[model samples]
Target: MAILTPGKPPRATSRSRSDARTRFSDRASAWLNHPMADIVLVLTASGLLLALGSIMVWSASTVFSYTQFSDAFYFMRRHLVFLGVALVAGWVTSRIPVDRLRGLGWLVFSVAGLLLALTFTPLGYGVGGNNNWLNLGGANSMLRVQPAEFAKLAIVVWGSAVLANKRRLLDQPKHLLVPFLPFSLLLIGLVVLQHDLGTAILLGGLVVAVLWCVGAPLRVLGTLAVLIAGALGTLVLANRSRVDRILGFLNPGSDLTGINHQPMQALYGLATGGWWGVGLGSSRQKWGSLAEAHTDYVLAIIGEELGLVGTLVVLLLFVILGYAGVRIALRSSTFFGRLVAAGVTSWIMMQALVNVMVVLGLLPVLGVPLPLVSYGGSALLANVMALGVLVACARDEPDAKAWLKRRATLRSKAPKRRFSAVLPGRS
Candidate 1:
């Protein structure tokens, strides 16, 4: 036995700390493995992101909104309206039977296709050099819609249904490529014609996701990947603006005021944010230094206002969402559910990755917005609705369904009481 020094505290051992961490990890893993965990996690994460997004959008768009519309809350009000619509869509989608969605695959696909075709009519107009918006009313109206955004959802639903139905035949190239390839190619071609390469890439990725979920042959997947890469390269080279962006990404110092301006300002915002950030709604860059502060560079504003901690929170929420999505896919009882879960997971995660990478200057600016967090009405609607679908798939899991049924039975069997029972009036 050793004598302890007077008034001196014993030091905590490294082994003790390690043991504590292990115990916490075990607890977390066990909780997350529960039958209801996926649905809970999805709802929690999605809700937090939506709330944070609304706050950040208002913060980032104030200056721009005031400058253009004379009302500082203009963008924020419009964003709230879109959020309301998205929430309604999500609620409706979550209530839809997963199997019914499979039957609706073709109809949804047809509607998306028709909308895309409408983008070629006189009602279509270009924004930021991408002719992807269809104006329902005059130019001054706020009814502009992006068909490509909806096409992303359509591809997931339709592709999953088709692949699941032909699951056994996916081994053969003919069965795999016949209708799926032609339809997907048509959609991508339409998007490309609208000059929306980013959405086009997302659509192509959805195809790969569905095929992979159905266990397409490795050779077939490899060939498709190569073709997609080649097509992307060709498209990049064909656009002079895209070429300049690539150059700017490679040599950021070469063009400080042109292609590199927005990205450089974004970096400055991030750098200024430091660790804790400058504080919410206190970003210096959003005052007009950063372009598209409410849309493309909203992440930068988040960084500037909330600091690295804020940005990390956003990233963590997405990771949680992705984890729940993948878990749902794995636990889903049907092939259609699996494909939809995987496809939507890949789509949202990939898009978020691209947006983050662009803000971090790791990739050229591709004009893609952060999902669920960006200020675009169409993107927000599509994302939340996809998440609702994901939640429905989660609920379709055998374990989740049983758990839900048990809860429902318990509630129904419980005795009902009137408000008078709790009041002093009567029993």
Candidate 2:
């Protein structure tokens, strides 16, 4: 028996506490299992990352913009314009019918391939020694595009369509490798010729993901992995700069002022940030200490200014985005949808992992920008459009479709307000 104080309330018993916890857990599980959950999660996570990206881009680019363009907001303004364009594109993509994508996949892939091929023409230009950019308008114009970015999406859509069609025939190696392997190799070879190994690696990963989703045998996958490894090794050995970076990664203390400068500076920025960060825009690294502060090294700036907590938040958002993508893939009714969802999820997550690892000095500099967070018009546009496709897939899930139909019915049956219904003396 327990005695209660005269003026104090009695404490809750363990059984009551346990019951409360059980009820809370039940509610959470139900909410997570709701038909609308995956769609909501994807949209929310993407939105948060976009918002944060805008903020970080503005913060990280202020110094560089002011120095080069004599305007602090130059990059930010450009980023906003790109953001607006991307949002509109994403909205349009989200409305596109999933079934139509299959029919249009080849056309999209062909267009992307054409654009990529044009990168070697007179209109093509090199950036950071990689001839992977196409300059539109005159040479002085700012309207440049990276066809490799769009190629990522093209591969996902086209590869998924082809694999999904050959589902039954996938058991035969010839059927699996005929068209898909040839086309994928062509795109990857184009990217490699431009010396953009990072994009090539990503394209390769997409191929692996598509094949795995279609149930390729482990032995075949193992052979492909070895081939990819050998190719990458050969590519690395072919370039002195690439070899230097590899050596620098292996021996961090060898070249402080050369190949290791950027990595070391990134580490310094992260170290300065400590736990909470040095506070947004207060980063010392952004003040001429860090290169590509708004692009490839933006994560370093994020760590410098926002600290570990901020970095963790960004990571958590990616995790949520990845989780929603997987959920959508699992719930999809068609094999194409599954392959697409899985492909996009792998693309984003793998890119994010690579970027983060590079910034932390765990890997050599790969020039891979942090998706959505980095300041690149082409990348931002491509990523958001891909996300829109993911959302469309989520909506096409059987349960989600039923829920949406029910919602539409309810919305249609609801009473609408008349113009003068609420006005005084109006019935």
Candidate 3:
């Protein structure tokens, strides 16, 4: 009997494959075990904002709901519904791999682009002098979608992908200006057509910020800035209402009865509240003195109710959110994550700043809301989802999540057993 030689080839291949699998498993396990406190901080703050917004929206919109919808809690109910939806979106989005979002840049932007193009169709509706909403399917029985919101996200997602991919070559006009500028212009054109000047400015700002963050050359940014200014000037001239607003902005007292009514009312609302505020849910402005109290001018209502302290708190939250987001972006393992996180951070922070400024009369009324602190289903939902992404990014860091987890574990462990059960009979 001869002893057969072992199959060295198969054995060698098996060993090599096993070693490779073990190495891959080790890396995967290490990542999962990492702490994620940054994600928790962002999520906690965002959740708090949403909750506060719900209360404020109810306080701000109840009067209008009674007068316009014949229900005392119409807007409040609607806002709660939107909050639910947004939470779901946030949860779903957080579970998604951050890498998948990078590939989605074009598709997301394209859909949003189509929606923007549809604004000219009969389905588009002009409201409060802005042609921004699209009544898809029909005017009577259909969803009125705001393409601008989606467009904002698309720009963040897609623009970040581009800037990230072109990290080194963005200095070249052929790479940066040609491809980036045209699409941005196209989107900007749609927004301007909607007469949403503020959002257009915001989107423009985000693109520039994201580009610069990715290290695009200063000259390229300067050129884009000049182009944006020229384009804005042209748009302002072409639109008479926009011109009127600009003129009114320069001299708010010039037309107290007409164009300046909203700002005047907002100022009046803030002035009447004084230091401690008129108390929550007792605002006089929400009774129709200030238009869009829950949507565009909720901060005025906040001022009238929560006072300067309240406004300051709102500002501080934004500052904190901004600071946290930028930190997460800096700490991100991937370029896309950094850009996307930074882009989202910039979007919300800028919008919140713009809204507060408008409410405070530092800027023209741009109709931008205070993120989760304002009332609007679309606005709340989008913002909440954006926060979820920020949370996921923060979760990548070990120290932050680890600290939170340790604290949480300690809390759970320190608690006593159920009293009734422990006492042996109350159940």
Candidate 4:
């Protein structure tokens, strides 16, 4: 390929083909080795997961939506709108500078605090025994908002900023114990008061993940773990239904018709789906056998309608997201960016795995939806925003800067020529 074009530029036939290949190779290499790879993976995986989620939401919610709202496309349409909002939010977030975003962390955290506090007031509503939702547009409007979702993002952003600032003094447990613990506890306490144990646990996990990312010592983590463990124990003792669910999770054979009904139905749906699914929307479970098919248990519907291969594909996308997110964290130049990027990534991917585990019955049902693959507006938008933060960090990676410089250099060095070639008679 390179023989004829040795010293002089050749004609546009084989030589042009060679140049195209070269350009392709250069682009591919830059993507593979540079932090830009993270951006590519983030976009690809999020798009695939969102598309699959939309299809499965439609399939799973068809019967349920019609039964409840007399419309088959109710959940599907709402989720598509949510997706559009999230994309715009993510775009705006990605455009903001990281330092500025970090500075706004406290404001975000404070706003989330206010929202969480409002959940206990008259504007708050209960669903599935949890009063963690706020009515944003009143009952007649049918618009429900979940403040806990925003709290998760708030803790991650603010916690990262706090920890990154105190990175040097973290060796002293007191320095780590001041504002971070107090702020996290305020949110967690409010969520617990809302009777949403699942969100409390998720927020607690976020706190630990942020501290761990910023290099908190073993003693501090152990101390926090013991306190959290004791709190969880207290929670289990106080709640009979939570205890029942845990016992049922331990003994899957017991109470298949009562406390175990949901998980059992999920298992049945999965069993009904063999290898290639029952063919999209043809799953028998969605007819009347499964509950929460559109929201919390959407992945179970994914398993039932899309089959094992489809489930595996969804999981693989998560793995790619995790991989890319970790790379972005490692490539980040600033401590605050790295810690926040890692915290958001951990919170998101961990929630997904936990949700998947709930469907498989490995863990007690947590009511936590899959990251970008669930049918919840607040959660879907919050997760996409967190992803936007990661994308911003990816843009600022040192390797990303270097790649940009190299591309610019190549552009400046390449020779340019006029489009007019030597005409047969005029030239």
Q: What TM-score, over all chains together, does every model reach?
A: 0.94, 0.95, 0.83, 0.88
Q: Can you give the lDDT of residue 352 in candidate 1?
A: 96
Which lDDT values do the candidates have, in the order given?
0.92, 0.92, 0.80, 0.87
Give the alpha carbon lDDT tens digit for every residue of 1-427 in model 2.
8899999998999999999999999998999899999989999999999999999999999999999889999999999999999999999888787888877789989989999999999989999999999999784365889999999999999988888888889899999887998899999999999999999998998888878877889988899999999999999999999999999999999889889989999999888888899898898888887888899999888888989989899999999999999999999988888889999898999999999999999999999999999999999999999998998888889998999999999999999977644777776
lDDT of 3 by residue, 1-427 (tens): 5455787433356778899999999996675444553564576677777777888999998888999878889888878887888899988877666778777788878998998888888878887878888876553332567788878788888887776777677667688665666887789878987888888998898788877777777888898899889988998899888889889999989898888899989998888778879999999988878878998888888888988888777777777778779889988878888888998998998888888788888887777888998887667777887887777667655465567678889999896876543556654
Which portions of model 1 show Cα errors greater than 4 Å?
A: 1-19, 419-427
User: lDDT value for candidate 1?
Assistant: 0.92
Task: Point to the candidate with the largest TM-score.
Answer: 2
What is the lDDT for 183 in model 1?
Answer: 96
Per-residue alpha-carbon lDDT of candidate 1 for residues 115-137, written as tens digits (9 for 90 to 100):
99999999899998999999998
Question: Of the candidates numbered 1 and 3, which has the greater TM-score value?
Answer: 1
> What is the descending lDDT order?
1, 2, 4, 3
Give the per-residue lDDT digits (tens) of candidate 4, residues 1-427: 5467567875678877999999999998876885477888888998898888888888889999899889999888888888899999989887778898889988999999999888889988899999988897955354778999999999988888887778889888889877999989999999999989999999998898888887878888888999999999899889999999899989999988888888989888887777888888888878877788888888888877778988899999999999888988988999988988898899988899899999998899888999898888999989999999988888878887687778989999999876977878785
State candidate 2's TM-score: 0.95
Report RMSD (Å) for each prediction in the order shown.
2.2, 2.0, 16.8, 8.1
Name the better of 2 and 4 by lDDT.
Answer: 2
- Which residue window of length 10 is worst by lDDT in model 2? 418-427
